[model samples]
Target: MMNDRNVVPERRFSADDSISVVETATGKRVDRRDFLRLTGMGAGALAAPALLSGGRSVAEAAEVSGTVPNLLRNGTYPVGLWVAPPPGETTVARYAEIADAGFTFVTGIDGCGGFCPPGETATAENAALLDAAAANDLDAIVYDHRISNIQNHPSEQWRDVIESILGEYQDFPAFAGFDIRDEPNASAFAQIGGINDILGQLDPGVLGYVNLFPTYASADMLGTPTYQEHLARYVSEARPDFISFDHYMLVGARPTIREDYFYNWVLVRNQALQAGLPSWVFILACEHYGYRLPTDEELLWQVNVSLAYGCKGIQYFTYWTPPLPGFHEALVTVDGQLTPLYYAAKRINNNYLQPVGKQLLPLTSESVAHFGEAQPSMGVEVFSGDEWVDSASGSAAILSRFHDPKRPNQRWLLVANREFESTANTTLTLHHTISAMFEFDTSERRYVPLEKAEPTGPATLAVHLEPGEAKLYRLHANQGD
Candidate 1:
């Protein structure tokens, strides 16, 4: 059984409070000061130190390259929100507002930590929400509390309860999947897997969605020795349709990013590739407890970094802020007003995520190379140079290479600025083998010729990336021509 304390609850912590409390993940009691120190929210930890960079040592490249595959099972590039509009605010207009903000889907509609009224029947509300979503060209994941916890019930009642809960919603065109659970322990894998099996058997078209805990979770919370092991067991035992996890690393008053942020991505990206499954990540959107409100660059940083690491989908945590005490300033206010963060997310989704995500959907991740002063550890490969590219000089950046399965000679490179608070001025030197090059135009949703590049032979292209921005380039290699 999953630990009850592991489930996400409304956190209640103040910066100045020194009272002893139980750390949520470890289940160990500690004073408030210790919790702050462990979470990187202590007084002296104002600036984020580069923990991933050290001695320059190149590791052997892996023999196998992982393909992301076409995992857009819902037929749209997913830009989802965790908390949809509250129950009483469920309207076609409300969903239209969500669509206007460039969100493609909404999850946790019925039960997102007391967002819904007490004693509300989620099945009935979900039906109405689905209708609204379909009208606005959006998808929804059903999150009825009873059905989500189906494993806790008797074995025989699983089918009846599942069918009774999900049977009607399946026919709705906007119905994407069922919200199984969030942040489950390894001990609960068998039960979760059984539920997923039945879900697949009954309806193959719909997905079984479950989000895991981030690398920050303690062994006690994960019920495993390490976060990688936790993910491996989840994939093997749960038999999920896709992998999803939430990592709220951008925290503290001064907004220092956690050290293991990229390390977590390395693990998730590798695991997803190995499983041949698409992966999704939850971007932090709300301010609560130790986490501060995300700035525009910070938000874009999260999305672009996830994309660079080959995540297939994006969901914002708490789109509509929960009514809990510590929670505040989500994309939408609790009273239905839009916030500045909402517009920032809108710009990101429309300008970058949707277009780039669609372009990368059918491509395979060949490798990711880190370039600049600070290189992430945990076996992340450094960019020494490649056959088609001589070097990438100036500014820290992440370069992710992808190739089309049918056309091996064609390649795509996504170069993202590593700095969230500063711009990167980069110069990429292409080798003689690259016959043609182009940049993806987000406005046109197509590739346009690189204005500064030569038609053939070695070429140099200047890349200017804003804070947390990434540019997609398409390359054609000469094949013994």
Candidate 2:
């Protein structure tokens, strides 16, 4: 537990200071020590909430200590590497490198085919892998385990195979969790439910994972509305440990790629948020059949955008370039060297994101407000413009973008250009007295100041955005101040 007095020696930001705490009311009397722990304070920061201690309110205890609630405070999540085995190297070497890469977690199994290593040796192999991860103080998650395509195997057989693997190695310290299948269509959700049932029968302690499409497809098919409904069935009815999804960027998709993706992320994730589930995203680092591999900048965008939308963990597509070449696109080069994307992970994890994680482990929130139509159309509604401005208050504010009261500092705004590749003129006015505005670049993982408007009381700001690009704003101000 954190001590409030020790957490906050003094206020860091103030009215007299250049940066004031902008959103909501000030001096809310937060517990400092708890804040430090929740906000991922300095190394000397207090410890995290003790979980499973006889059903105590871990969040409340941390809050009483002085920590703020879990929100986007700071820090790149501690980065994890998806270990790839070289052409001839045994699984042991792969495990060693995964630990060496500073990744505490490994996803999927070692072999290339659709089956986990067979027979009695499978348990021994799993134990060895667990030993390697533990020795390096790393955590390992076995996802897309060697179950053949559901198209090939019956759901019952799939359940049996998954059950055996879980039963054999449920006690291993290195086992992080299990993702039942890679990508399943709507029809496969039932199989996923069956797998979950089997896993529970074996070891209820381990987490069950499944991947959904990038955007929620309609239940009519696999799109958002329907997918959300189906997902709810599993969550409420099946009650799995955690929910995971595959978020991929097609080759040559859009102008503001990151922005486009972020909105999609928000739409789909908002559903998971409503379900109150911890979410993880599977990012595409490798090139699909004919698609191109993601560049370093694009890779950073995937991680940052997902994190901004509040994904607690990330899953990478391929770590090793397969010996067969044509189908192999990996974060590492063919020779098995770390690609630029690897460094991007290191930088965010070791520095910016890690510090923030120390403070608030971002859990999904139900405080989202949807604007306009869903994706493939205008990603976000153009809220700030000549028509939307308030002439009397001389302020520009979009009521549609306002947040639900449930979230503390739970505010987010989506702004974008009307025309693709065309710069447009727009002004954003704040209904409330404007104190501070910040925009985060998902691709770059940096924040920039939107030049403050010239007029004082009325916040009139000019926005020049390219097509397909959108800005997510974090606004701060006291209510009725």
Candidate 3:
């Protein structure tokens, strides 16, 4: 049962046939090919790939070295914000507020610069931004809006601009990437690819940032027949180190969320899985236009949902509380006061996201399935091999299966409560006997053994989760069962 406090009125979700999900019962389908794909092609054969960067596969390289790695420490995943430039002068005081909010990187609002001086003036401006970021324990994804205008020009001119910006800021340890463009269509892929080529030649370590349009865009807007096709073309042409995009649909006075919300994730998850690329998604942190302030659950919905789909990082649409009107609901206010959303974000990020993210980064996503009322139409795997498993019926949950390439026998499960405004009691039932299983404790920040259970008939692991909360489990197999 849901706590009615913030329960959004029951609404029908959009049906996207391209990404499949099926009801719990198997009777309707004759052959469950898609269902099997959604689960696993039978466990041991599953191979989870590493995130690719600069055309190099992290899984392969990291495994060969035989050392554990973290996304933050390794500088792979960036949980961050879209910040406006400093006010008037080049001061990083805002960065302290950004750092205080627990964001790792600060990306500009537009290409080159946003709310800052133009041209060579930006060179000096970004220097201050990066300096402040590093001093305050944050990273800077330098945005050079200047490059956008001149990328179409001759190589010499473009090179001069790209080099000028990179030259001024590349040495800063806080420098993460150059925000090359935002919400680009297929027409810009070739151009983006050309710019990325220059970036590679200059500094392969830096990410060439170009955020894509969400699935809701029209074919004309995307410059491709379908949204997936748009992503495919960009991946093929741009050779980006990673992919990012934003879609703000949690709207209306009653807080109506668009069905395309989850659909957009499917597109990103499918593509990222195939490309072995990391993915970043943005959530609406501020109120503007028709969209109002998001409840804590709404914020968790985007962040946790992204994690379920294997998103490596998350970003807030605005962290600095832009000077625009009606945008007061963000983490920080225009006057730098903390809003309730800020504290909510802090708890989710520090207490939940940071711990889980650090733990899940090294493990590659093998498969994902959903349960409860809003389940993905494909199907969730409650049973595998001779073992039959069942989750609490009617509890909306997202179950993600992951595997460490180095430890193939070991497996992981990340269960997320999908209902944005309700608490879910999920009982995971396994019909077949197992040696042992454990749950990851985010609070203590370690795995604690779950009391061993024998299958008198079925073994059950029950968990209670707050709205938009998640839990991770580890299953251990005993030999010669």
Compute each candidate's TM-score over C-alphas.
0.82, 0.58, 0.78
Provide the lowest-lDDT 10-residue window in model 1.
57-66
RMSD of 2: 17.6
Evaluated against the true structure, the overall lDDT of model 2 is 0.46
Task: Estimate the TM-score for candidate 2.
Answer: 0.58
- Which residue pairs clash in candidate 1? none
What C-alpha RMSD separates each model from the true structure?
A: 12.5, 17.6, 13.8
lDDT of 3 by residue, 341-440 (tens): 8888888887788788877777788777666654454323432223324445547677777778776556787878877788988777743545567889
Off by over 4 Å in 3: 1-77, 88-93, 109-121, 156-161, 253-255, 325-328, 374-394, 431-433, 453-458, 479-481
Q: What Cα-based lDDT does every candidate model obtain? A: 0.72, 0.46, 0.63
Find the 10 residues in a row with the least total lDDT in model 2: 1-10
Which digits, one per residue and each the tens of the lDDT, describe model 2 over residues 1-481? 1112111111122222112111112234333223222222222311211111222232333333232111111233534544345323335665666655445466544222223223312233334556666676666655333432333455558666665444445445566566454444444555556666655555444556555544423233342245446566656554655566664554434333333455566555665667666567777666534335665545645554555456666767666553332334576665667777666556645544444333224433323222222243324333323222332222121222334355545355544333333444455566444566666655555556665666457665555544323355656555544
Off by over 4 Å in 2: 1-83, 86-102, 110-121, 143-171, 194-205, 215-238, 252-267, 353-360, 363-476, 479-481
Candidate number achieving the greatest lDDT relative to the actual structure: 1
Tens-digit per-residue lDDT, 298-358, candidate 1: 8998998888888888999878875544566899987889999999999989887889998
RMSD of 3: 13.8
